[model samples]
Target: MTHQTTPTMLDTDVLIVGAGPVGMALALDLRYRGIRFSILDASDGTVVHPKVGTVGPRSMELFRRWGVAGRIRDAGWPGDHPLDIAWVTAVGGHEIHRLPFGTTDTRPPLPYTPEPEQVCPQHWLSPLLAREVGVHPEGPLRRECRVDGFRQDPDGVTAWATDLRTRERMTVRARYLVACDGASSSLRKAAGIPAPSRHATRVFRNILFRAPQLRRQLGARGALVHFLTQPPALRFPLRSMDGRELYRLTVAASGHAGNRDLDEDALAMVRAAIAFDTPLQIVSENVWYLTHRVARRFRSGRVLLAGDAAHTLSPSGGFGMNTGICDAADLGWKLAADLAGWAGPGLLDSYDTERRPVAERSLEEANVNLMRTMARELPKEILLNSEDGARARAELAKELERGGVRGEFEAPDVHFGFRYASDLVVGDGDSDSDSDGDGDGDWRTDAVPGGRAPHAWLDEGTSTLDLFGQGFRLLSFTDEPAAPPTALAALTTAFADRRVPLGTTRCHDASVAALYGKPHVLVRPDGHVAWRGTQLPADPGRLADTVRGAR
Candidate 1:
């Protein structure tokens, strides 16, 4: 797409291209920071296939922080729909392995967080975000506005975007430009950043259709996702979306008619998974390449990348969008700090340093999940069974047991246990200390140095996440008189004087204290702990400087 230069000039603090989930998330973060930004997308506001379904728990925590967790939770998914993931020979046939997670209604109360993940597919999610971000003809979120090219100077970035409707070109100048575009990010390619693939690419097809009565048809057999383990072609999920009215069937998109058309064979593969006679309307079919890749670099001068623009991974673990949400959170604060004039020169650089490794880890994990599924050996006997199917069923069950199918669904470690090793993290002397708090620890270290602050229940129906509003926070255990040592008093006062929003709280509860590890924990506006010490520093001014990116 070439740029058509025009006279109209638009200026904002930040300009975001591609209104995907990650882009919308960046806009939301910028809005919370009180920064002016404009978000644009090439397509009109409608999500047809809904590639992403389940939001991870950590992403849900961030959603809680952003004040949209409740709305997202209530986004029309049937409250009673079973969240269990079942692997079977067919949708209603020969069940192999099942991870019986309760429905949204019956889930046991979690100790770490008040908000668990919600199953709102991307189509439903996108509209909710669009409404919250103000989608209008001329608003910040301008649909059908395609970004063609951009140039960056030391001061700011000048982008050339075309209005698809009027065929008019407009220039947008902003302090920074973020590309939340997908894996085939033209913006990243335009900026000369290469996303080298780590694994061989494979093609997949996502078939979205409306099966309003399929839920009732399946009756007691209804599940959030049904992994079809049938033969050579059908072995992916037929997932329910929008309260069972809509469904998406994923299948391998190779060894058949090319991408130009969807062959009847593929449709038949889906039909075999549906055991009941139900009304079905084929909505949309999407053919996409699944890749395991990480960008050579995440930032280019005044331009930065987020979401699939920065990295692309297989969708096995469902970490693609959640990782991007984290990227948005990490970059949003640094941008706001830089614009507000308190961030250190090193602050912006940390974005790439901190997020790139996380993406790499996610890439590897997703690839592993993909391999586990792809490498499953389906014996000929299992595929072609006759009258006495007992032997075939026994063989299939044994394969499922050894395959560790449940690993795909229960991945709390991938979502919550990742830790960041950056210059910002003040490491304890031991190298093992970094991985100290893995799993459900009372006090697990935040993965990103300035990442999402750990979640802890502070009171009845309240979370420690609720404590962080739009500014920095300081948690000091009053029970420990020696905690925020007298030396750090000056630094605390300096933060107060700088007009940096800071919330100070003193907790005496043994559980909360044990979780925090240190007596004094200084959290950033975005809720990641910036500086934590068993005891306060001797020089409060230096502590303030360190927290303000002045190390």
Candidate 2:
């Protein structure tokens, strides 16, 4: 007699552990690349509470590429509503410094990227992204499915998961495995990856509530976020979760300086934060820890970590989720290339070399924003309605301006300015790219190698950003009557011979050419400039090798 074992198989090239925004974003990107994947979530496919408030511009650009930006943009957030961030004693209380960010409809068109920021919270965003990747049991996304464990060999990863509802066992064989299992990622732990804390971890309580009349009361005075400048552990953002009745108030659950505070009721906390006597109902509350931890490495063998699994940061600037989404975008293309048998020996290695540094930078920057709110002096009298109160408000406004608080609300460089410096990226002259924010602008656009290719409107309804993503794009600039150099014309054959999908776009616009800083620029599938030069290289295969991480 023989005991036979049958393993439930998945028709998947990549196995994704977790169906959070980061995992879903990776799925969406992989779907865009026409790759086969299976994404599993332990919990049901319902976003009961949302944490992330706003999606950054760069994330929007990637979402635009994935074909869900329109759905996100039109996902019921009022276009005429104010996008401002206001500091107040409460929602209807004394107004202090208000950063007058005009309504999305009224704000002047930005010169940088096509898609700007949107106020779509995670609860709404999660379903939208999940649907984009498909949610059926037979489809890529599997709701109520939990990945218990996985083992990665040199050739592939074998993940063991179970259907939570049925108590059924399953096996997923894949070329690669991505762990988006969140901050306390068990897979990351099982893989023995170290993500040491970069800053002191603090606990916070998010109180989700519905103030039905709060929107009416805050009508003209309504801002996206109301920073309650209360003293001690109470100072945090009371945000408009849905731009409507729904709102969330964040409070420090942990006592000041690590003291324990019992009897910290959620209702009492909400009342203390909101000065207005508006009708508000407590929906639910979730307590979470804000830790700054970046993994030493994003990849271990055939398994990779994305999102909170790779790095966890303070959400003061809303960079945590956006950073994770960008990680998915970066990894998706490389994973696709590897699966399609076109990836170079070192292509996948560049994922950590590029994204890990960005995570560290975002972590440090988010901490700065957190400290700005934490270390702020509340002056108990800022809430008073008297002359002393007015003076206190006026003084505090000046201090905030001098403190560079605007960096938290308007950080474009944090999103668009990171440059990949690895063996794959061919630097023209200097390794440094446009990373510093130039005062008013969140990011300065420059076409230096290793940076995001600068955006330009080639024609109405067409952007230069649309030129990349599918494959390696060569922006072969031709000076009107003069044709492309013979070497430039021959580059396509070299790339094709190596099975690298390379496309050429001849640009006559000198302004567009000037923004790129080089006559010919190679844009990677992730929309970053891989190489740039005055003319085509003598050996185009070497250029391909350099960009593809073969060399």
Candidate 3:
């Protein structure tokens, strides 16, 4: 497990470890910003079994910004396939409850966002992002490269890595290092960051199989997820993973009778969970521990953590990968700013300040979803095929309605509602600024400072979000030309004096103004409102410095 050599030196602007979706996302953002860096992944960039299934709406928005949303949407998951969630005794067993979310092609357009959620598995997503980051021998991405250790000094970090194929030792020096490594992050551990568990750890097994005829057999009754309700046998989700032949059956592996180890008794247990006589081909099986952990520190010195390295949560709400992608988007711009010689010292510090609390809230929300499934009351009579079984099933379906089952399926608030409360955010304490709730207004659609900039379609193809992510953009609501107001000339002057990148977009649309609720708004590169007001601030340079992390 050890390989040592007189490591040759390689210099770069950033060094990223573990090329999962998170790491590759950071690389993509960095590439978009034209930042020079090297990404190291231990595996050969092949996704054997994708654990993550659905890309959240917020992540889809980020992927849109990264210019990969089209590829993902066309990544072969059918657009007309049913996107419903069904609860049943087995694959072809007694029905209990169902939540019907219309298929992608049939879903209505929403005013909130242009990009909706897509069913892109990690296997499809990872290689796509890797290809975007480049897989050539001389390119930025290095496969089969493992990080052995690293040392951080005053200037940057020097990471020691081994090319697994050749056992060639190399040392990479970078101005900053981002750890997008997975839950058991070697970089996170090496940096001495504490990732304490938030709840009791639970064990589970995922049985990945191929039932080529199951879709044809079900016909119009097919669903995205089938929550198995067979009491004491299986109570986990049996999901249609690929919209085709592939499926994943999540089974509890602790005290249940279905708790057979994958290597020893997987086939028997998988067979017991299926009610149909269709031919089944077991592709793979793996055991995973579900642990909810959030690191106390997202940044330590020049080293920063993103994705599962920064936090880990239950895979219930499909929040794990999306959360990590957001982490990369948040960190990508900050890293670019610092390296481009425009970011202040405090700008890097705000990454943890902004992202950590969002991680905490997301963890709690996902845990609540997990508890809902765990606390469901399953009775034996519900599984019977008699008339009593019909009554019991109907009753349980009504109970599910009362129990708030839709919260698990439709949660846009969890994905897009978190507001950042940090030193970098500039609040409007003016008469229009409302602070009615937990003070900072954690979740709302008001275009409040530190919240996500509200989405609105300006033209046939463009969104209000399409205006952000290049640099600091000043959204001038007036129909006037793209010129700084006489009152705001000081802000423009201050930015120019410091060589900061800023732009002014003059929007005349009344609907956009209404959604923004401010005459002028300063948006960060990550598409969150940095500051908002009807007029320029009294101390524009001070506001500029604060937002860029100096104040």
Candidate 4:
């Protein structure tokens, strides 16, 4: 577990800490932009628990940009395992509500995005990305390295790190330091940024184990995620990780009372969730506190926070890692712009203004999902006797009907519906109107203002998401100007001349044109629309400066 260590001074445009999905993702973006950067992680390059089970549609779209989406799709998750979200009294117990989203093969083609979410968990995903990024001896990825401290200058940052194996200290000087570290980020705390909780915190434990016969034992009852509802012991998900022997069971830590050793008792808790008797081997156990929190700020001098470092939310809606991936993408381009010297002055600061609100919204939505589960009152009759078992079943069904349990599992809105309300976004003066022309000021569900440009199928094999992978894309209709106004083209050329990695494309499709609500739409490198206008702006230099953060 040790590697040869030679004294060295490493220099790069950016130094990224934490090699989780978000850190690796930021590395991928920086690589594509041709930005010189290094990534460091404390652990030797291996993933455990894989807390993240599914890649959200938006995150998958970004992966497609990185040229790894196809590999992720081909990852070993069973093609036929049910992708549906099912709620029940137990794994084999009474089924209450089911959102039957078809498996990867059975689902109909989506018009908007080619990369409809896949079931690849983190353990499978992390290695594939690491391989593509190339962890050579002097490559940007430095495994088994831990960042201990960093100091920032007006122009750059000097970071000190330790080799976990050799215990040798080293220094890295870079223009910027990005902390993609997890929620309990030592770096964020070291930088003196406080992440105050927005709501009460709750603790839970995840148990990863192998159950070879569990899937077959359950037979037709096998599901991607099974929520256990029994009280006092298990009340969380028993999910199938990759449909093999691997599985994850989440249980409330509070149920353990004060017991420190989690052995047979923990196994028995998992056993109670399923109706079938199958052999199981416990792999690893992790106890984590779920908090709804957003850091007071995301940036400090030359050091910036991304991913779990910036915000942490309940996993009820599965937005934890996806939010971080989006953060990497947003910060990737802005950092590249700044490094390349074409970025506007305020570009980096906008990262906080635009992303903080989205994190707040995600926190609120996830808390709502958690409340739905926490508020359920287990009926006394259900726990009472065999004599009133039939009456208990009736009461359970009634409660399920009123409980709206499906929100816990099927939250497409949280995954894809967030919009940015930043100073850079240009509105058509109708940003508050709904689809029906009602000015309700309800922006969450409404697709106006800064919402993600809708998805549409452009061809038999391609989707609108496919068009935006490599760089900044400008999707315009044929009726609009054949080329962007001269000013816009000048800005594009300026960034391109400096090797900033931006691209512009025009889409003549009638459907995409309508979805974007403007003739010319400028999408950022991360696929979020940065600027949109009914007609090309008169001064392309000003627009470019605005988009590139020059203004």
Off by over 4 Å in 3: 1-6, 255-264, 430-445, 479-484
Cα lDDT tens digits, model 1, 368-399, are 88888888776655544564455766776777
RMSD of 1: 3.3
Which has the higher TM-score value, candidate number 3 or candidate number 4?
A: 3
Better of 1 and 2 by lDDT: 2
The reply for model 2, stretches above 4 Å from the true place, is 1-7, 255-262, 430-443, 480-485
TM-score of 3: 0.95
Clashes of each: 3, 1, 0, 8
- Rank ordering of all candidates by lDDT, starting from the highest: 2, 3, 1, 4
- lDDT (tens digit, per residue) of candidate 4 on 1-551: 99877756788899999889999999999998889998888888777778888998788888887889889999898887887766556676665455677778888965445677888898998888888787848467888998988888888999899888888888999999999888999989989999998998877888898988877777676688877667744556788888878988887765343555334476776677766677978888887778777999999988899999999999887888888898888898888878877677888998998788778888887888788777776654553446585577567667766776665665556666666666656565663532221134332222354566556777776666666645667766656465646655775676576455566667777766667676777776666666766776676556566666666
lDDT of all the models against the reference? 0.78, 0.85, 0.85, 0.76
CA RMSD, predictions in order: 3.3, 2.6, 2.9, 3.9
For candidate 2, give the lDDT of residue 404.
88
Report the C-alpha lDDT of model 3 over 158-225, residue by residue, as the tens digit.
99999999888989999999998889998899999999999988888888899899999888778999
Global fold similarity of model 4 (TM-score): 0.90
What value of lDDT does candidate 3 attain over all alpha carbons?
A: 0.85
